[model samples]
Target: MAKWRGPRAALAVAAGAGVIAGLTLRTAEYPGMLPAGTPDPELGLGLRLVCAAAVLIAATLAYLTFARRQDEPLAMTCLPGLVVTGVVLRHLVVTLPGAARISPAARIVPGAGAWVLLGSGVVMTAAGLAAAFAVRKTA
Candidate 1:
């Protein structure tokens, strides 16, 4: 197995953590009459399910990669996290532009979690690609 396997495994774990953190954190913050700003994930039912499903699949792939020292499973691990990131970004893209037009007091802003989720997805995908292209030496 190539030496990069160890770091790739770590990347899988980090990506899993990123998925959890992203769902737990706010997707967007809106200024309002409430003391604390309104957050998209404050209504957590749908997001909770999405987060759980992605993390579970990613964990399984990570285990398969570690146990077998196989790059294929590691590459597969990238899918779940990336899907979540895509969904989140799509929501933002489809919704955010007209959100602030509702009222002067109603302004939606991207939250820290959005950036973290995006970074995590990018890292996971890059690691997967590297694992896919790694060279195996002939005996």
Candidate 2:
């Protein structure tokens, strides 16, 4: 068993998770958008973070997989990044436009898609947290 395999696998998984998270944001049901109809519900900070994380993770994984293990401390660093990214993503999703942005008459109710987003985000965050903790424990 090679030492690099662990980090390589983790990065690939994180990239896949990132892709799923980005897809969930695509569905309708804008939860916290001010004005209730923010044209593009798909554009959010969480999505950006996950997408960025995914790309960065994948790139890091690719480099690690091919470039040879340069350092002992670099394995699974993306998991911690995933943990932070997932938390930020969920946070942005839960409080999208912020309370002050919405008018008193406007009430945002989550649709089925919104529920899906929330649920997926929670699961993603939980998984990231668990992975991060596990990585720490092992180290």
Candidate 3:
């Protein structure tokens, strides 16, 4: 747990905070954030912001509580936070006003950058959990 408790925990907190900041700066439903020609979906920016905030808070709490517990599972405590942070930050960034200006291809790409970020976040989270699980098993 030492590995997760120290650097990993700090990283998790940073990621969560980043996501929250990103979302506050750029709401998900804003135009020019999604890929070009993407139909205007009826999603609410307020809802996405709320959800992102929830994820950040949950992650922080998990780190402070479960992650700090002596016998707790590192994966169990940190996986959700890492995954949520990655996904949320990705969404916020992809949907930011300037994202489209940087890469128009992102809009044409099937599923767009936000989707890619979400998928990547899931994979990273799974990998982190697996690594933690393996360590526990070995010990």
Candidate closest to the true structure, highest lDDT = 1
Deviation in Å, model 1, residue 115 alpha carbon: 1.5
Residue pairs with backbone overlap in model 3 = 35-107
C-alpha TM-score for every candidate: 0.79, 0.42, 0.45
Which is better, 1 or 3, measured by lDDT? Answer: 1
Clashing pairs in model 1? none
Model 2, span 1-139: residue lDDT tens:
2454455445444544545555455433333545744334333566555555654654465455446633222334445445545544554455444432454334433334344434444443444444445546666
Model 1 stretches astray by more than 4 angstroms: 34-44, 135-139
Alpha-carbon RMSD of each model: 3.8, 6.2, 7.5
lDDT per residue as tens, model 1, 1-139: 5677888878877877886787777766776552333333332467557756877887787788879877777777667767766766765675454454444366677777777776776776676666666623311
lDDT of 3 at 121: 44
TM-score of 3: 0.45
CA lDDT scores, all candidates in order = 0.67, 0.46, 0.47
Q: Which ten residues in a row have the lowest lDDT in candidate 1?
A: 34-43
**Which ten residues in a row are the worst by lDDT in model 2?**
69-78
TM-score pick, better of 1 and 3? 1
Query: How well does candidate 3 match the true structure, expressed as C-alpha RMSD?
Result: 7.5
Off-target runs (Cα >4 Å) in candidate 3 are 1-4, 27-43, 65-74, 77-131
Best-to-worst ranking by lDDT: 1, 3, 2
Best by TM-score: 1
